[model samples]
Target: MALDPQAKALLDMVYRVGAPRFHELDVAQARHSFEKLQFALRPEMPAVASVTDVPIPQARAADGVIMARLYRPLSAGPDEILPLTFYFHGGGWCIGNITSHDVLCRELANHSKAAVLSVDYRLAPEHPFPAAVDDALRAVQWSLANAGMLGIDPTRFALAGDSAGGTLSAVTALAQRNAQGPRAALQLLIYPSTDILSQRPSRREFANGYMLDTGSLTWFFEKYLPEEDDWQDWRASPIRAARFDGLPPALIITAGCDPLSDDCKAYGEVLREAGVPVEMLEFEGMVHGFITLGKFFSQANEAVLQAGEALGRAFAAGGAS
Candidate 1:
């Protein structure tokens, strides 16, 4: 499909209004910029189920401090727990926070009508590698364990994220599968960083000039991974996993113009070959993080709604539905 005029205008505006996102900024500054963009969007989103930040007192990771903002619809009131999504924000695992993804979460919660739990996991290089995987796993387990208190229907829950956040989402599902932890009904991965190793042609083809340039990716990866060796670990690279079988059903969203596009496509294809039910979409002319640019890009909002529609179809009637 041709580039939507709105998409082009917003893309140009995003490039001009601010600087390309970088990993050099501290969490506070990065989050500030992210939140600024979110507020700028003030998008016309559907009236959601509901939204609130519920502290999980029992969810302290191996280190400490594990809290997630829980989102749901009004129908799924405090008394009714609904299928949940343990959502992680993206920023190469160093920048984004719940506040930054607040609108996206709202859109998802309103559209998916599930208990969307946006996690605030520990970032790096302060806490690297397994720390992120551990935090994500802990968040999922904590949500399931406290499903009652969190008003989430344990039987109907999913896991989702975008970009680096998408990487963590994939890892969380794998950890649950291998350890026989609570099952996630579905996995929603949006332009996820499936593999840290830049081995694909798209990596170079779409690398430099795109919104998420190869240069920025390298900088982000360096800050997140203490050593290059960490990329080999399956925790850092889901594509390196020995098997993707028996994992939850998946919804993989990719950008036709993204450097990591092939990696995301490869994951969906591999998962399907492994006997998992999967759905994939690559929006042409879109770049990395198109899922979160609703403020500036119409395609961003459209992608979210499209993903939400799929989630509704995948999760309608409940987890088994």
Candidate 2:
């Protein structure tokens, strides 16, 4: 399918404005550009009951602290303990922070009637590989252990993220499974990159012109991977894992024109084969990262509502629908 009209228009505008590609800029410059682009694309912040910041100390933080933001919808009562969605933002694990995903998190919280915890994990080049993974798992453990203080219902927890964030969610689930740790009710993966080694057809077919290009992916991976061999590690690439059994139920979202579409589909198939319940939604004509640009892409809003519905069902009593 061709790109959606709004997605195409946005791409045209990006090119016309001569925006620098991710691969062509330094980390700081790339981050600034990414934030600026997100700022222009996102709609006004939606009204949520409340948004607050909490500090999470990592496994070995000398003086640094991982930041997390919690979003609660108006429907949530002051004393009520609600299901929590621990979210990670996408920027190839190199860029993107809570601020860039603030509005989307609020929307999810509002629509799902669930508390959303957005993690600002350590970034790449400076922190590299297992660092983000460590922070991700730690955040989940922290959330579960400190549920009461955070007003979270420990029994009803979900892991959600986009792009690189989605990758972390998948990896964290696998880690928890192996450790017999806190289980996530559902894993919400949006246009995620599952296989670091496999070069799927979508990667070649939509490698250029799309908002996320092949070169940019390479740049992001280079920034995140500690060593070349780390690419094959299951924590870095969940597709390379020997077993997908016992992982959480999955709600996978894929964009028709995204380079990572095939990656998400293949991952979903693997999960289903391993006896994990999976629901995959492919938004035809949409490109990667469309979910974050609701102001420009009508499909973005639809996708968010769909995600909320999925969360509602998964968090409902008696498990997945």
Candidate 3:
């Protein structure tokens, strides 16, 4: 499909105004550049609860002191036990937080008719790769061990995130499978970074113009990894792992114009080949971070709805588990 008018408008604005020459800029300047790009997409969005009618509160992961923003869909108030989604916001695992991704989580919670726990994990460069992964694992562990306290059903929860956060979600699943961590019902990955290699054709082809460019990605990788070898570690680059068997069911979302699009495709293939029930959907002509742009971009809205529906089917219907 051709680029929708709204998505095209977004690309035009990004190239025309938001694209910063961060090559020589300081770290703070580059961070500002990234934030400006996001703001340019939509200067502001309604509060998460307004968008999805969810009650939002802050929770803490006991071990790492990781903060988690819990979203209970208005459709399911206190006293109503609902399926849960533990989400990590996407920002190459180095940036973004609960507020940056609040709207997305609420939509997922409301649209999927399930509670959403949007975790605010520690960022990279300051905290780095394994830190985020560790926080994610511990958050899941705490959620399971204390599900009753949080009013969640331990057996009815799932893991989800976009981009690098998606990497954490995927790795968290593998961790559970490998170390026998708390079992999640399913995993939802939105254009996830299953591979840290980032050398696929999509990365090269969309390197310069896409929302998440090669240069920016390089910055993120540099900031997130503790060492070069971490790039190949399964915890960082899950697609590099030898096996993905025995993991939970997965729904992988990919964007045709995203630098990491092929990562999602490859990961979906890996999951399927490993006998994990997997569903893959690629949004053609769409750029990276479509989930965040849905308010102004029609394809993005459609994609989120499709994703929410998929989550609903996977969790509520209780299939493919």
Candidate 4:
């Protein structure tokens, strides 16, 4: 499929002469660039019942505490306990913070009628590999353990994220399954980097022209994984996990033109083969990162609606079970 005109226009603007790509800039500059794009393209923030910043105390003292923002839908009653979706924002695990995804979390809460907890996991380079993964797992566990206090239904918890955040979600879900911890009702992965070691066709096919280019990916990986052998770790690459049979059902969203598309599809196939239910949605003619750019792409809004519906159905089933 041809590139969506809006995506093409974004690419044209991003790649205009003298514009510095992410790989060309320092980490701070790259993050600023990424945030600028998100801020300019994200839709206006919708009203929600409440938004609270919660600090999650890490199990390991040295890891300190991570922050998460919880959003309660406008329709939620003061005393009602809602299903919870622990959301991790994307930025290759290096750039984005809770504020970057505030609006998206609000939309998810309203549309899914679930409380959305947007986690601010420690970023890369300084924190490095396993840091974000550890933070993600800890946040979920903490949230589940204290669900009553947060006004969330512990039995109906879900995990959700996009891109690197999606990777964290997948890894965290796998870890929870392995540990026999509280199982998530669903896993919402949008353009997730399932395999860092992937050499799939889509990696090369959409490598350069897409918004998330090969250079930027390499940059992210390098910053996050300073150890070469960590690339094979299941936490870093969920597709490398030993098994997937007992994992939660997944809604895997992919962009047709994304370099990570094939890897995402492969992960879905792996889940299906293991007898785990999987729903895969591919946004054709779209590039990576379009889901958060609802201001520029109509499909972004459509995708969010689909994701919210999936979360609602999964939470409903969980509650019944």
The model with the greatest TM-score is 4
**Model 3 lDDT tens row, 64-144:** 366777787767765776678889888877667777776677778777887788887778677876888888887787777
- Comparing candidate 1 with candidate 3, which one achieves the higher TM-score? 1
**Could you tell me the lDDT of residue 2 within candidate 4?**
79
Tens digit per residue, CA lDDT, model 4, 62-102: 86789999999999999999999999999998898998888
The whole-model C-alpha lDDT of candidate 4 against the native structure comes to 0.92
Clashing pairs in 4: none
In the predicted model 2, the residue pairs found to clash are none
Best by lDDT: 4
User: Given candidate 4, what's the lDDT at residue 290?
Assistant: 94
Candidate 1, residues 1-321, lDDT tens digits: the string is: 344566566667767876646654565676677667656764655456666776654343454467688878645665765777789999888877888787788888777766689998888878888778888887777777777787777778788899998999999888888987766778889999988885888898877657777777887788788787887988998988999888989889888878899899888888999999898877888877767777667778788887776666667745632
Across 35-102, the per-residue lDDT of candidate 2 in tens digits comes to 88789988788888889999997667794778999999879998888999999999999999999999
lDDT of 2: 0.90
Alpha-carbon RMSD, each predicted model = 2.6, 1.6, 3.6, 1.2
lDDT-wise, the better of 1 and 3 is: 1
**Whole-model lDDT, model 1:** 0.78
Cα deviation at 37, candidate 2, in Å, is 1.4
Candidate 1 colliding pairs: 41-295, 49-73, 49-74, 50-72, 50-73, 81-151
Q: What's the lDDT for candidate 3?
A: 0.76
Model 1 poorest 10 in a row by lDDT: 55-64
